[model samples]
Target chain A: MRDAYHEELDSIGEGLVEMARLVGSAIGRATTAILDSDLKLAETVIEGDKKVDDLQHDLEARAIALLARQQPVATDLRIVVTSLRMSADLERSGDLAQHVAKLARLRFPERAVPQDLHATILEMGQLAQRLMAKAAEVIVTKDIDLAMQLEQDDDEMDLLHRTLFQHLIDDRWKHGIETAVDVTLLGRYYERYADHAVAVAKRVVYLVTGEHADDLQQDIPPVTRVEGA
Target chain B: MRDAYHEELDSIGEGLVEMARLVGSAIGRATTAILDSDLKLAETVIEGDKKVDDLQHDLEARAIALLARQQPVATDLRIVVTSLRMSADLERSGDLAQHVAKLARLRFPERAVPQDLHATILEMGQLAQRLMAKAAEVIVTKDIDLAMQLEQDDDEMDLLHRTLFQHLIDDRWKHGIETAVDVTLLGRYYERYADHAVAVAKRVVYLVTGEHADDLQQDIPPVTRVEGA
Candidate 1:
């Protein structure tokens, strides 16, 4: 049986998974809210961000307290420290989801996305939500393969983002400058959301393998150095 | 006499200050690069970001090692954790600066900011750099009042951001949709740069006061709770 101290450590990791789940569902619902101009759903997502923030703050306080009380070293120390970083990433992801919902609220009864672009925006949203879901799964299972997969999903997100820009710059666009501005901002919100999800997965990879994801991907050895005096 | 352990903690804080200074100068140069379409200057900013990343990785490793070796409690512990967070903010701020430079490089000989909008963009860039300088100052001094001042600067940044949007949506916008897109992204990069700078200052305030900046901002007493079983 695990001691109480270890249980506390386990709880911090569990909190991260729960936070990721909340945000993953949030992006999915937030995407629907924006596309449909559902103010009610948007309101819930915006209000729900507080719960994510609170979880982070609580987890942070507990993590520090654990360090003070338990003083676990080596791998245990790395786990607690990494958990803090993961929580920060998850909290930021929640904020990005809220930004999407807030944009929906800003547009009110009117749709934020233009009709022709809705399909692309929807695809971006769905892909972003999938990325976050997989990130959460990686957190739970610590499967390095699952963590690495987020990069390809992010590349897909990038392709969709480029498609969005192409549509914007195309001469066929009949939308006014205001609509284009909204669309531009919306595209950014989704892209940044996906980036954060990928970052979370990378952190998991680092924790599991003791190597940076980019270093592993590019076959570059991480340099070892002592800080110069 | 202060021991080696405390000196190590002091060095971590110093490293953060150094990072803030590097990225602060980067934003200033990137602003010039974009305004003048100077590929050379933009290249320097892009390459310099690697230095910022190196500093962060080195600092993080040292921090984790220190946590393992020192096992600080209470205020000392908070300082180390907050340093790690502040380093992350500075590193991200560096990336934002590099994004500004990349935009400049992408636009090449063509200025990204059209003739009419140059003043606003320049102001945003200057304000972002100033915010980072002040944030660095706050990290070193931990002056509560100086830390509080970042909020006002951030407010100014938001106003500038809105002005950029206004220019984009102006009925007389003759620069076409492509320029509008570039301007929109530029505004976002600057605004986010300022936000990260403000975040760095707020973390310093949190470390010094043991109170969250937002909690203090609105006079909201932070809630106390015991985790439910």
Candidate 2:
């Protein structure tokens, strides 16, 4: 009976890992769709987001049931609680991706973002995706070192965010206000995506260290300080 | 032994309520500081935020200790978890208020935001504080109706957010791009403050209903649609 119960718990863990993968992939596709102005990909991401959402709800229900029935203790309980919080963050990441897809759909082939800013956004998205994957790997493999490294990965995203903001403020492109708004919002979304990825890493840290690391100094160190104007 | 444990839990719950009250007042003071350009009030909020942060950490540690020592089950476990989550949200709300205070500092005596926008911000801040207060009330009383009502309150903040965005986009002010950025950041901070308040209310919902509320949903009933550009 104990073996069977352990097996069930393992399956739930696997389910959470799968959900994280779907969320990570959705974010990547959504980012590509936005930058490339690919409506088809954007549509695909929009559709796929529902899967991420469903998987999240499924995972939450499973975790709650585990807590309810299994009466998990210590590390097991922490894993269940972390699963609940991580799933919420993942769902929000999916929502943010949908927001990006909607932006792509609304603007379409016109490419609301200027060409110069695209590279920065692309880099930020790539960094976010990588960090997310690392987070998932840590969850599956229980790699505390990888999780620790994932925190530092946010530095790249913050750098890209700063660059994107600087471009928005710069005189080039005749200071296009509308695209600037889009760019700023996109930067924020990517930054937040990376943040959620770091949050996953923090959970892993807690699972390993047996201490809550949620708000203990953000994963992303300051890449560049914004001088108060 | 059980009686002492219960008393400790009660004491912790009381402390959470007091922290909530402090957070709500901080929001009020921060908003007043913004509107009145009361630097002193802003400074007070900034300083008070550390107390909220300290309280948040204290509450989390206490909750964890309770869980570890008491091995609470079912509804008791849920309450502890809800309190933990609610404290995190309240901590973030304090951070958001600090962000608003930072905005106040940026404006100095000049008042970067126009008088019209000021009223909108004040309204948003007031609504957020009220929701925050109600969240604590619900937590204290386990009042589902009050919690549900707070969810609806977030709609006003969303509407005000959109209105503030439109005003910024209208570019009626001659203060130039910096003004726009500051206003945008200010609006973003207040909008997020409202989001945290909604988050607290949602936690209350989960505490009562054992299910997370759809936080993206603004108003509860008629689905009042705000015009989107």
Candidate 3:
């Protein structure tokens, strides 16, 4: 009976890893769809989000059931509860990725990002994807060092976000108001996607160290506010 | 002993109500700060977020302790777990209010919102505050009907959000790229604030009915993708 109980717990962990992998992939593809203006890929990323949502729903139900049945105490209890929080972060990350895809679809047949800013947006997207991938690895391996590294990556994500905004407000920007709005929203999507990824890794660090990550301070956007004229 | 356990549970519920109240007040003041360009008011909202965060951390610790010591099952278990989630939503709502205030401070001595769009931004901010107030009421009363009412209010928030965007993309917009970006982030901050409040209400509905509200669908931003030019 104990074996079966712990097995259920193990499965919940695996479910979270699967969710991380899916959202990581979604953000990557959504980035490509927007940069390359690939409607087909955009649609796939949007459709794939349901899977992440379903996985979260399943994981949540199982975690609740495990808590009830095992009445887990100490570390086991924290792991179950923390897994629930991690899954929520991953699910929200999936939604952020879908937002990117929806934006891509909205601008279908026309590239959403302007020509010169493509490299920056692409870098932001790729960095966001890598952050999630590393977050998943942290979950499985419980490597505190690897988890700590997500902070630096998040800092990089913040820098890329600032660069994207610089392009938006530059006097020489040729893109009209509509494109500026798109780019601004796009930069936010990528930056927030990375934040969720970093949040997921932080939860793992908490689980391993038995310390709350919130005390460590979290992601701060690179630019605090738009520069006044 | 059981009586004290139940009292502990009641106290967690009260903590949530208090957190909700703090954030509700914060958003109203934050909105006033930005619209009036009141640096002191903005500073108040910014400083007040610490109280909300402290309440959340305290509530989380107490709730976890209750679960561990009491080994609550069935409805009691659900309450403890759900309270944790509610506190998280409220804490995040508090952060969103702080974001509005921070933006106001950043553009200090000068208004962040343009004169023409002030009315729309004001409306969004008020609606956000109202939604959270009702969510606080729902937490205290466990009124399913009142909790259900939040969905309609959220729709109004979405509408206000849409109106703000329309103003942004209009051909007549003369605020330049920097103001446009500020408005875009401002609109997003209010919209997300409202979503978190609605999420708090939905969790109450779930607690009462044992039917997941996510199954009932959640907020769809008034504008899903920035409109294509």
Candidate 4:
């Protein structure tokens, strides 16, 4: 019975890593689809999101089943609950990628990204992919240091996000409002994608360290404090 | 013991309603702050979010404790797990409201919404608040019909979001890129806030009916089917 329980836990972890990989490929393809105006690729990425969503749903069900059957306590309990949340973060990351693909499909035949900003968007996409890959590694290995580094990696994506806005906000901006809206939404999608990756990594940090990432900063009190009424 | 467990479940439900009310008010005030350029009001909303955050943390801990102590099965287990997810949705809604307040502070003294779009934004904000209030009602009453209605209400927010984009995409768009970005982000914040509200309502639907909200839409298949290996 114990062996079966451990196997279930391992399966959940594997499912999360698989989800990360799928979403990472998704953003990469979605980026290329936008940069190259490949409508077919965008459609493929959009459809592929169903697989990620299915994986999340399956993982959640299995986790809940394990909770009901095993009645896990302490660290084991935390593992199941946190896996549910990590699955959610990864599922949302996939949705963000799909949104990118949908945007690409929306502007089909016309390049959504202008030539000058293409490099920044491409870099942002690459950074997002790397962050997810690292996030997956953190889930599998439970490497606290690697998990901590993902947040810093997210800062790079943030800088790229800001750069995209800088281009839009510059006085010399020539992109029409249509392009501006497209770029604004695209930047936001990538930024949010990176954020979800960071969130996944943070969950791993908490799972391993028993401390929330935010709690480490000490800027605010611990999130779960029970006081006598 | 059973009575104690039921009371704990009721407390969790009440906590969710409280969270919904706090977030609903936060968005309403944040909207007013932006529309009126009231910095003090914006600051108040921003600060008040801490209370919402703390409440969510407390609720999550209590729910998890109940799970551990009661080892609840079936509906009871589902209730605890779904409450956690609902709490997350409400907490995110609060964050979206805070983002609105922060943006208002960022553009201090300068109005975030232009004179022309004020009515549209105001309408979106009100719709978000109303949707959240309805979500709170759904949580307390577990009214599947009302929960189902939230998706339609969310459609109004989506339409308002589209209208903002239409204005931005028009050839006559005179708002500079900075204001354009601000407006774009603001629209997204409200749109996402409504999405979270709908998510909370959907959770209620699932909890009551044992069917996911998406499953009701025949366009998509059930989200969790494992293929033959």
Ranking by TM-score: 3, 4, 1, 2
Tell me the lDDT of candidate 1. Answer: 0.82
lDDT, residue A190, candidate 3: 85
lDDT of 4 by residue, B1-229 (tens): 8999999999999999999999999999999999998899999998999898899889988988888888898888999999999998898888889888877776778898999899999999999999999999999888988988888887777778778877776778888887887887788788888888988999998898898766321111001011100
Fill in the DockQ of model 1.
0.34
DockQ winner between 2 and 4, please give it.
Answer: 4
Q: lDDT of each structure?
A: 0.82, 0.72, 0.87, 0.84
Name the Cα RMSD for model 1: 7.2
Model 3 lDDT at residue B110: 85
lDDT of 1 by residue, A126-174 (tens): 9989999999999889998988888888777767877888888889888
Comparing to the true complex, what docking class would candidate 1 get?
acceptable
By the lDDT metric, which is better: model 3 or model 4? 3
Native-referenced Cα lDDT, model 4: 0.84
Interface RMSD of 3: 3.7
For residues A134-209, write the lDDT of model 2, one tens digit per residue.
Answer: 8889888888888878767877677777777666556554544545556666776777778888787788788788
- DockQ scores for all predicted structures: 0.34, 0.28, 0.49, 0.30
**Local error of candidate 2 at A69, Å?**
2.7
Backbone clash count, each prediction separately? 0, 0, 0, 0
lDDT for predicted candidate 3 compared with the true structure:
0.87
Q: After superposition, which runs of candidate 4 have C-alpha atoms over 4 Å from their true positions? A: A215-229, B215-229
* lDDT score at residue A203, model 1, on the 0-100 scale: 84
Residue A169 in model 3: lDDT: 80
